[model samples]
Target: MDEIIRQRIRNSKTLLGPFPNFFYEKTPDYPQALFLEWFQVAVESSVHEPHSMTISTIDQHGSPDSRVLILKDIDNEGWYFASSSQSAKGKQIEINSKVALNFYWSEIGRQVRIRGNAVTMNKERSSKDFLERGKIAKAIALLEKQSLILQDPHELEEALTKQLIKLNRNPKLISPSWTLYKVEATEVEFWQADKERKHIRLQYNLRGEKWVKNLLWP
Candidate 1:
């Protein structure tokens, strides 16, 4: 390694990092409360696309795969995300529903980790979600083959254009495999960076019908 590059790596731990600009007690007793609070602050901050997140899944052969996606919605129902059931992530969920979700707001130097099992939303809800999507999104979803290598460079663009026409003919058309899946978080962790490296780590664990808060070593 170059000497200067090595020196830069050595200073990383103490170089860049936050107490957060939002209202947070030194220690939080409520996990969800803290999460929502942080989320709100992140949204209000200068972070671009604060709702963007990375979701990780394990394939059938037990290989890990992850991709960046927008967080569709979140509520008592859980974190909402949509994908084609035949897609790699969806197929992996079909075999093993456990998954991990990560949210990072670099502008605010905050991150959240959620782990839980993914469940497909009911057909009624799923269809409603599909129809509620914007026309272009619906068109893309209509092309159900996600993550597949295209034989022709223009294949997707051509297909999307064709799909748009069919959609225009029948506005109610919906894709069969476009599903909304929810991740019911079993455990959640919130991490906040600190200038002095005394980072804050708070975790919430679900225990038999209740959530328990705990502190973590940074």
Candidate 2:
């Protein structure tokens, strides 16, 4: 069985792409600009869930944990994402503000990695983001028992029904635990894969108010 599994894994192919060329020299002064460009191309290429990314946070035990989440927004303030303050990732962020975000568009053989410190946005912004969510999403967030054990499935349904009714009575209801966080990136790396095994990696590092770009060997 072990030999069979190993053979299966070793036979698998990767980095297969009519991949786009990365002319790192022609990249923008800021990493955000290049990120937006690459993101747009991924969208145009019909990549699935192009806005989805893996967010990694350190747990209380000093271990790494990661999960996939949707990208909310991005700007000079950095990448935006929202979650319940009571959630595992949120609690982890509070303990250690440092985090890492990774965006991989496998179809295009491209990836972007960001290392940064996350900070909570203003209350108004967080509230606005929560209100924009669909009713079901808002109801689930109101429960605020994320990453908790579920003893019974019926309990969830009952709780959700109650929350939905509460929303109907007060459409403006918002969860205080729902928070929007922005990651202020210290370094952003862009990687583009080549069919011939050569890969291009461009990294932008923030130093004193200016961004310094460098090439990394693949």
- Report each candidate's C-alpha RMSD, comma-separated, in the order given: 3.0, 1.4
Top candidate, metric lDDT: 2
Candidate 2 residue-wise lDDT, 56-112, digit = tens: 999999999999999999997799999988999999999999999999999899999
Residue-level lDDT of model 1, residues 1-218, one tens digit each, is 69999999877653264446433355455565676778788877767887888999999889999999878788764788988898888899999999999998876778899999999998888899899999999998899878777899799899999999999999999899988999999999888877766677778898987778776888
**Which stretches of model 2 miss by more than 4 angstroms?**
1-7
Measured with C-alpha atoms, the lDDT of residue 158 in candidate 2 is 100
For model 2 the local lDDT of residue 163 reads: 98
Model 1 spans with C-alpha error above 4 angstroms: 1-30
Clashing pairs in 2: none
C-alpha lDDT values of all predictions: 0.83, 0.95
Q: Estimate each model's TM-score.
A: 0.88, 0.96
